[model samples]
Target: MENKSEEKGITRRGFFQRILVGFGLIISAGATGAIASQLLKSLMPSGWFGEPYVYRKVYAAPITEINQVGASIIFEDKANNRKAILINNGGNIQAFSLVCTHLGCQVFWEKERGKFLCPCHTAVFAADGSVESGPPEKSLDQYPVEIKDGLVYISFREPTWQPEQYFRGEGL
Candidate 1:
C-alpha cells in the first residue's frame, strides 16, 4: 500500500511557511509592545521621572506680586512627591514643607491667624515653623529661600521613594 503517514504529514514547503509565519508573529508582537511603551511614556507629565534626594528650585514667584503679608502660595513638588507653602511674613518671605511633623498630614496657611495649621489633630505651627501646640514635638520643616532681583525662589531636598523618610529635616 502507499505510505499513509506521508499522505497525512506536512510537505517541506508547508513546514517552511509555517515557521516563517510564526517568526513574523513574534516580530510583530515585539514591535507593537515597544511602540506602546513609548506612547505611554510620552503621555505622562514632565518631571515624573525626576531623581530623588536632589535639591532643586521647587517654586518661584514675583515678590512684587505677593501684595500683602501672610499671603501664601501652595504647590506640589511632583519630583519629590511633597507639598510646599510659601508665605509673605511681614515683608519677610519664607517657605516651608506642608507635611506635618506628627503624621505627615498636609498643613495649611491660616492667613487670619498668620500661622500654619495642621487640621489633622489641631496641631498649630507659627509662621516661622515652631510648633505652637499639638501632639507634634518637632517644628515643621523649612526650605532655604533666595530672593533674586524681583522674584522669590525656594529650594528643598526632593523627597525620596523610601517610606516615612525625608531629607528635609536632616539639614539637607
Candidate 2:
C-alpha cells in the first residue's frame, strides 16, 4: 500500500520544515515592520521642542541683596529669559532653577517645612535640590554658587529659543 504523503512527494518531515519556514518568515516580516516604523517616526519634524540651554557662569545678584535666610528671592535673567531662586541659608548661598522637573510650574521654597514644594502636583524637593517625594522622577536642577568680592555668582544654563523659519517654501 502506497502512503498518500509519499505518493505526493511531501513527507511528514518536509511538511514540518515548511511550517517552520513560514513561521520564521512571518517573524522576520514583523521585525522588519517595527524597524521601519521607528525609522519613519525618527524622520518626522520635531515641533514645539525647544533647544537645550547653553550653560555658563553668570552673575545673579549681590551677596548682600539676599538679606533674609531660609527664604528665596526670585530673579530673572532678562538676557536669557530664565528664572531662578536665590537662597541664603544662614550665609550658605545656593541657587536653583524655579522650573519644576515634573512640570513647568515654578517650585516654591517652603520656609516652615524647610523644602521646596511644587504647588501644582504636590511635589517636594529637599533644600539641596534633591527629590524628596513626588511624581517627578528627577530632582530639580541646581545652579553652582560662588561669592566673589561681595558679589553673588551663579553658574546656570539658559535655553536659547529659535523661531521657526519657512524653508523650501514649506512650514508656511
In order of appearance, the predictions have TM-scores of 0.56, 0.57
Candidate 1 per-residue lDDT over residues 70-162, each given as its tens digit: 678875656546567777778777788888999989888887788788999999999889999999999998888888887887887764444
Of candidate 1, the 10-residue stretch with the lowest lDDT total is 163-172
Q: After superposition, how far is residue 171 of candidate 1 from its true place, in Å?
A: 26
Off by over 4 Å in 2: 1-52, 67-71, 160-172
TM-score of decoy 2 = 0.57
Q: Judged by TM-score, which candidate is best?
A: 2
User: Candidates' lDDT values, in order?
Assistant: 0.78, 0.78
